[model samples]
Target: MKLTILGSQSPYNTTGHNCPGFFIQDNQTRLMLDCGSGSHSLLNYPNDLQNLSIILTHLHRDHYNDIYNLQYSSFVFHNQKRIEKPINIFLPSTPAKIYEDILSEQNSFAKYQIIDENSSFKIGNMNISFCPTDHPVETYSIKVQNGNRTIVYTSDSSFSAKNRLVEFAKGADLLICESSLLKEHGFPEINSHLTSEQAGIIAKEAGVKGLILNHFWPEEPVQKYVDEAKKVFQNVIPAIEGLTINIPSIEKELDERS
Candidate 1:
């Protein structure tokens, strides 16, 4: 499978960066992880509108604002007969107001399904599952598996000893984790997000093959987040907008070859 960073900024979009969004594709499936602000403009449009599935971690504006744009695109495309079916969207059902708003506005262009920690489904060759995360709202961290390769996306979440995230993400080929702040920033006591170091700890404890850090605070230097994560886990990759990463790192590929 392939994971692409559509945008990595957090809270809001900035001068050259957009809010959190990611694109994942394998041979038979096309899935979008989030649709944050400014991410709509980066989508492949008519092409992506067809046979696409979306999953939202929570109702945070920065994580789902672009979904409105996608709704419009789906509407137009279906009207034009460019696509025969509505796009599938899987999202948390809590924070009732936001969920109701989305349901009310949803036309026949997109099919919305409620997802929780117990949710498990398949799309093409990919097997997808969810686990609740340490976030204020009903947030979930997602796991996608195709054959023996697995990828885990830890959406907005804070560090918690009781969080099932490490087990949910264990042995993943790639862990796309949110690192919303630098360690020096001193995460707020009522934390709902992870620092780069915290993200590294999760990666190390989970024993994931590789780590991709995302959900950046726009003001901080990207390299600083990477540097902090590398302290605990050396195989750290900073999430860059428009960069696509192949699962099963080159190391694994070499090992298989050997």
Candidate 2:
């Protein structure tokens, strides 16, 4: 599998760091986990984004800023190539209306189909499942599996239930989670984020092969976050844009990489 982080910041980017964007691909599937700020430019407007067809996960401007851009661009791309297949979109029920607004979608947007909890779906080479996450907004976490290989993505949310994460992450070759805090830093108002320390606990307990933390504050040195996660997970890693990680199974990727 190939995991590429297109963006890895929290707030909308104005400087260098772009918000959150990730791409995952296996033998038969290519999925864009989240499309935050600058994603449209990253994909190159009017360019062939043909490698991607499946999209899933949370709702935050930093997570979906380019929805309209993708829609408009896809329309152009499809017409140029005489493409026929509609883009398959996997979305959380919580953000359907918001997504519609963002895309200015009439007739449920163009070239895309939204999948919710009420929907059971499949993409190439894998089966996917969504879980509710602890967050200020209604959010969804996801697990994708193919044979014994597994990958879990925690878009942006609190890790209040380590067991739940472990369930999704168990035996996963990779666990892409958010480490948005340092335990002592924030109060309860923070609601839906994890400190580096808590990030460690989840990775360790879940026994994931590798723990890659994203959606972090840029102010902290990468080493600090890595060190923090290492306390619980020996294979913990701080996320960086353009980083690529490949693990065999979501469960054991850390064991080999660390």
Candidate 3:
């Protein structure tokens, strides 16, 4: 599987990156995880959404403002071709109800279904599962497995509860985590966010192949964050715009190799 940060800036827009969108592709299948505000219009690849799916972390505006755009674009770009087919959305049962109420405002989202937490499901050739995370909203961390590799994503969450994270990300090939701040200042606010130190510890304990941090605060010192994460994780990466990662897999041998 391949990963790209569609957007990674915090709500503060410190570096002008988008809020929380990330793109994942494996073989011929594609999924946009947490399509933050204004991301759908940014997808210009050929047949981008023809076989695309969306996995939302929560309903916070910063994380979901682009959903309506995704729904509208599908209809408009396909010459108003309607989707009597439902979209698969993995989310918590409660917020899933709220999502239904919100999307019901428009006819476009009438058919979508929400996959409850702890349930395993398949998308194309991938097997995926969701687990609760420590976030203000009904948030979920995703784990995906396919083609001999597993990757996990932990969207905006606090450091208070991390057991679920360790369970979900255990032995993942990559862990895409949100390190929204540096550790110098304790983040004990109402809508708290994680720090680089916390992310480092999480990844190290989970024993993932790599740890990539994202959703950085705009004005936050980038070096401070990177340096802090590096202290705990040797393979730590501070997310940069346009960065891409390909999870490794073995190439098939030709019959001639015999």
Q: Which regions of candidate 1 fall more than 4 Å away from where they truly are?
A: 106-108, 161-163, 188-190, 248-258
What is the overall TM-score of model 1 with all chains considered together? 0.93
The regions of model 3 sitting more than 4 angstroms off are 12-16, 80-88, 96-98, 105-111, 189-191, 249-258
Model 3, 37-109: lDDT tens digits are: 6555447533666567788888787887777777666555555454333344444445656686655645343
Model 2 scores worst on lDDT over the 10 consecutive residues at 42-51
- lDDT by residue (tens digit), candidate 1, 1-258: 777788888888876688888898887578999889987777786887778999998999999998888888898889999987788988898899998888787554999999988899998889999988888898989899998999899988878732488999989888889999886997674377888988998999999888889898888889999899988988887877887776756346423422
Encode model 2's per-residue lDDT on 111-216: one tens digit a residue: 5556554454667777877776777777777787777777788777676756677776776767788877775565463357887777777777777677888777
Q: Highest TM-score: give the candidate number.
A: 1
Q: Per-model C-alpha lDDT, please?
A: 0.84, 0.68, 0.71
lDDT of 2: 0.68
Cα lDDT for residue 118, model 2?
A: 47
**How high is each candidate's TM-score?**
0.93, 0.85, 0.85
lDDT of 1: 0.84
Per-prediction backbone clash count: 0, 13, 1
